[model samples]
Target: MEFENRDEYIIKKYQQDEETMIQLYVQWCSNHQIDPIALYQRAYPGQVQNESLLKAVEEKDQESIEISSDTLLEVLQMFGNDDLAFAVTEEIQKRSKR
Candidate 1:
């Protein structure tokens, strides 16, 4: 692969990784029969639509990926999405109590 600039290459790699993260999140939500968008809204009330998330959901492919709660939380935190991770944690706790 050839890149005109190192910055451009870095940015492209980051975007691709971010896309994979989003797709994983979406797949996790589907596995648990949860609405990813609604969960996101609860985490970020009054915020506008998350374009990346929406796009991920819309373009999601049917893949049977088993995502654990802990794994999802860690991934969200890795992406600096503490709010969303909190929401996911709450959901996990709620499910456990049921």
Candidate 2:
């Protein structure tokens, strides 16, 4: 799964797009059948990027989220290492209760 030098460069460049980030949010939510807002609230701990992404996805703003393959890759990252991610989220939630 190692990327070539060019591939890594492309991924970095691709990640620079806000649209790519938004699309990742959309795909991850769709794959899990959760609303993007709820998915962000549950999976990621902050409102900055995730909430913005959810808004972009749900609003269908047609800004460019759906057109980026790099975005799709980011969505996969949210779910792929999901065990650790979810575990951390749970702890955060638990701590919030105190």
Candidate 3:
């Protein structure tokens, strides 16, 4: 796809990266048997739904990828999703105690 300007290209690249991040999150949740939507809702209580998350769920393929807890947390934090990152941390802690 062609972008009109450098800014547009940057934005497009960020969006694509964000999508990858979301996919990674969803896959991580699946790998751990955690509900991604429920986790997202726990992070953002005000929003009933996350469109990108739902889309990722719908589009997820059979292939599975390794998503480390630390990597997922760092990626979420890097994307400015501190709340979600915290939620994931809490989840990790909860799972560790089990």
Candidate 4:
């Protein structure tokens, strides 16, 4: 449980909470009528390699788009949902502990 750095610990937790992050991403995207995959790609560009996640968005599958926590927050903020983005980050940090 000991982390060498705070960022390392936060990244670990963020990865652990991928499902929650994806849920928040989908909800935010749906609420704003934005394409989750497009937003994710825009946030990370060539860094995105999750075909399943992209496929989910391409197919309009709301419940299957699994986005990374960092990408989700970036996309949210990109769309001007700073409050919701912060909430999602807080929720992910909380859920990762459990």
- For each candidate, give its TM-score against the true structure: 0.89, 0.36, 0.92, 0.40
Candidate 1 segments exceeding 4 Å error? 1-4
Residues 49-74 of candidate 2 have per-residue lDDT tens digits of 65556556766643442323334444
List model 4 lDDT by residue over 21-91, tens digit each: 45567655665555666656555565746664654455554454445668777866765657656666665
How far residue 16's Cα lies from its native spot in candidate 1, in Å, is: 1.1
TM-score ranking from best candidate downward: 3, 1, 4, 2
> Quick one: best TM-score, which candidate?
3
TM-score of model 3 (CA atoms): 0.92
Worst 10 residues of 3 by lDDT: 1-10
lDDT, candidate 3, equals: 0.93
Residue 77's lDDT within candidate 4 is 72
Model 4, runs deviating above 4 Å = 1-16, 55-98
Q: Model 4: how far is 60 from its true place, Å?
A: 7.8
Clashing pairs in 1: none
Q: Per-residue lDDT for 18-78 in model 1, tens only?
A: 8887888899889988999999999999899999999999988886879888888888899
Q: Kindly indicate the candidate among 2 and 4 with the higher lDDT.
A: 4
lDDT of 3 by residue, 1-98 (tens): 35468779899999999999999999999999889999899999998687889999999877888899999999999999999999999999998999
Alpha carbon lDDT at 91, candidate 1 = 80
For each candidate, the alpha-carbon lDDT, in order, equals: 0.88, 0.53, 0.93, 0.61
